[model samples]
Target chain A: MPKKHRLKRVFGAEERQHQTELLYNLTYAQSRRIGAVTVKITVEIADFKVTKDSDSVITTLNLGSCVGIALYDPNRKIAGLAHIMLPDSTNALDNSNPAKFADSALALMLQEMTKLGANKAALQAKIAGGAQMFFSPAGPASRIGQRNADTTSRLLRLYGIPILGQDVGLNYARTVELYSKDGSVVIKTAGRADKAI
Target chain B: MELFTLSDVHYEIMREIGNIGCGHAVSALSKMLNKKVGMKVPQVKLLEFGNVAGFVGGPENTIISIFIGISGEINGMILFLTEQPSARVLVNMVFGTPKNTELSFSEMELSAIQEIGNIMCSSYLSSFASLISKSISQSVPDMSIDMAGAILSVPAIEFGKIAEHVLFIESVFSTETDNVSGYFVLVPDLPSFKKIMSALGVD
Candidate 1:
């Protein structure tokens, strides 16, 4: 049995209880402890937005050959995440928002984050996901995960957003969670411990 | 317009054809999934695209629609899914899970389904190609999960008549302890429709 599934089976019951408690705490604290925390984050195709009033985790789960961007502003403690499925907008049927693709998503995300009190210069990022889940022996273009990761890295460099951390090009899907309350980000991959930043 | 009619012999031939087509599809799925998938040759019937939803029964009628084109020949929609459980089972089987797990689509499941859809659609087309002795290709299949009525409610185009021709087949499969069902929907172009109908004596 794979480590993740085995762990899940062994700790599934206990984890369920903990998850329930975590959800409860997050829900209750959103109002009581996290003052003015609205948890208001929009699930945009490519870009996401967050504000200081948001105290809830913003995330997208199980990204396959898709790039997920998590941007945090320590000054304002606001974070945003988006799971981009394709590399470019040209392949998509709806291209109204080019940002829905990897290249454009990062550009739009940085642009929006700056508008929401995020410093363009001090904007830190931790990206995870862009896994080659399919059985593709062919390199790069055929591998959407590579394309997603490559596109994200290229765009970030072009725009000059310093990448603080990265975990990309794996064979498993990952779930991303952003803690708006403290500007913390968590990435959970198959058979691996949750990494936080 | 004189509606086409099928003779008893033609019906039997077409049913066999449907079964063969479904079998080829299951074979492709088995290869792609790299697991044992037992699927019975579907039972084919002619019905209005609207009424077709009723035959696929469940508490909440949901259907997944995909569009496939035979390059420049036929452009048709394929819809399936008897219920949510069936969809889950499909996702599980495609992932090669031996023990039945409560299937929830993660990112892997989405891409897996896209590839499976491609294989199944190709299998179905190949089977039809053999019977008709002609070539057929399909576009990338689109996946949508919605209430049957909502999926089929495309205003005035309900009665299968408007669509050059329609073939409805039910596919049944079982995994470990769970048994599930789905449908194979095919819409043939005018020329291919006439060929199939004529071979079956539907005129």
Candidate 2:
């Protein structure tokens, strides 16, 4: 195992608002992002992108599957989220529509953010989702969640962008929040409260 | 007159209709995923329509059942499954890698099943809509990683009658990298059975 693959953890609720570090528990709203113009991106079998200049983008990647939420806040206030499933759309798309894949989803999200005053060069990214929610020996397509995470990271690199932070490749589903106001995010998983980063 | 015979054109038509309806579902999924999904028409069996659970032994045969239900003018469940090893393969294909193996039993073990179920159910229902020519909506899928028997028992099978015609369709989806196989079965009442047979040019 490489040093980079080691799990990374962050301590939460040490400072800031009490509301910032919500205990990760199921009884709560699961995961949330508090900010203006919150664009909620939900991924089913399909991927979608939402951009907002006011609020952050809140997306849920629950257990039993893999989901990738790509949030870009180039202005540090304007944010966008792309809830993506499959890693590649090559097999998932009809050839006429390329934006359906993870790589395409990120491109589209960035394009949207750019339209909303986000600088492509200044764009910083946070990626969450891509859990090993299931073990299928069949191959990568069966573990769409992992594919979501891997493909997302790959696409980000292809565009010559740096990933500042990522919480991915776990065995649990996660809910992600992108706060546009402060350019922070909170990830909540089962049995734990929300932790903002 | 033979009450129950192959010559009973209605049964034949019902089988054909089941194949057509399920084929649409396969076609829809194939188009969306850009992969070919194969299907098999269900062999008609006679059992208490309502006692489907008893016949199938509910949770016993089930490894994990992931499904979503649609409640409106019509109600139906979309489901998917695989034996343990098969599930592993299915998961890897979906996630685009090999299994982590370290935390295979964790909650993450259910993600692939749920995701696949969601896709299948949505496509199946959409296909059904085309066949019936009726508008139908679906609730978000409810996925459960439970014993096959337990999940099967959740639905009461005793609402209808015994020995009604049932249709089963099996589909196999093969991609350059992997393959997925699934089945679709329809249990229609007698009158509906007759209508289906006529639709299939059987009766």
Candidate 3:
């Protein structure tokens, strides 16, 4: 498909090889036939994925104090998912990866989604994770989960992207999946029922 | 100083800290369980934030973690973690429950695990404190059963604020019949790290 070709053209040789390896890793990536072939793309920590393929499902796992944001353009069926680790990029030890911070991750995701022919005005967002896995009596660092969720929500508002759904800020970890076909978000946590939002 | 800039001597000192600290902890665990507890030599490493989760078992692996924050003389975070099955085994050993019995982590079981974490961490910290002659205090232990990556993110985020590289001391402790290997992770802040090195007369 043209979308697949575009993906190959967009990623470098090494990144393409990494994607190929991910595809072949059946334990992490699951494929299904839903009228058309569907493939899952895993967005690891500090990573993001944007695609116009309707049969693509972008997922990020084990979001504890981190946050996952999913953006979808209804008309064009373009989707983006970012697994953001920190609230801000300022004073970060490593700022090379734009997807690692809430502020920059949204900016990068929006740029990539627009490049994939998605209408910026039609983009809607769903967010998950930002859970407080541990309680600490220290300073702000103990509440980093709440900070990450707040920062991501603020950035989304700045981008004029309406947040359609969210499941954030609990004492549990989450795994999130964003479906491009229907712009739906599913949240999974251990010992809990999977939630679709 | 940057973690990468640390020389071999610094690493060796850190490793010794791990060795002494974990040795004390394993013995405390042995006393509690009333059985011989075996341990591997502690390892000290400087790792990227992303790679820290892989040590416990890939990022997504399910784990039970106990988190304790250290303050006063040496500021840092300490974590004791094990896979779900290993957690069950450790808890059962404490309760004298049959090894094959399943655990749903009832309130009593959860408290037992927390107490074990408290004892082990305090023993480890006490040894380090006495070694440096610095007074340190630890926060109450908090427990979570979740994905390793998620649990590890707490320390990773804290360390990320000061450096791209995270320095950690890890020790694995096991028991007989069931190899209930538990990992002890220590992440000290930059200033505290410096204090430790200076206290040990390293630099």
Of the candidates shown, which would achieve the greatest TM-score relative to the real structure? 3
For candidate 2, write residues B23-59 as lDDT tens digits: 6656765675566666654455553222333333342
List the candidate 2 regions with Cα displacement exceeding 4 Å. Answer: A1-45, A61-65, A74-76, A91-99, A139-141, B1-203
Q: After best superposition, candidate 2 residue A195: deviation in angstroms?
A: 3.4
Question: Interface RMSD of the predictions, in order shown?
Answer: 13.4, 16.0, 2.0
lDDT tens per residue, model 3, A9-59: 544433544564454443323322213245679988778999898877888
Which of 2 and 3 is the better model by TM-score?
3
Can you tell me which runs of candidate 3 are displaced by over 4 Å? A1-36
DockQ of all candidate complexes: 0.02, 0.01, 0.46
Candidate numbers sorted by lDDT from highest down: 3, 1, 2
Model 2 B-chain TM: 0.63
* Model 1 chain A poorest 10 in a row by lDDT: A133-142
Higher-lDDT candidate among 2 and 3?
A: 3
Question: What local lDDT does model 3 show for residue B88?
Answer: 86
lDDT of 2 by residue, A1-197 (tens): 54344223332322212333333322223333432113344432234555564543455334223444556654556666665545665654132333435766777777777787777887777787665443434322235556667778878887877787888875554666676665577777654577665
TM, every model:
0.51, 0.43, 0.88
* 10 residues in a row with least lDDT, candidate 2 chain B: B156-165
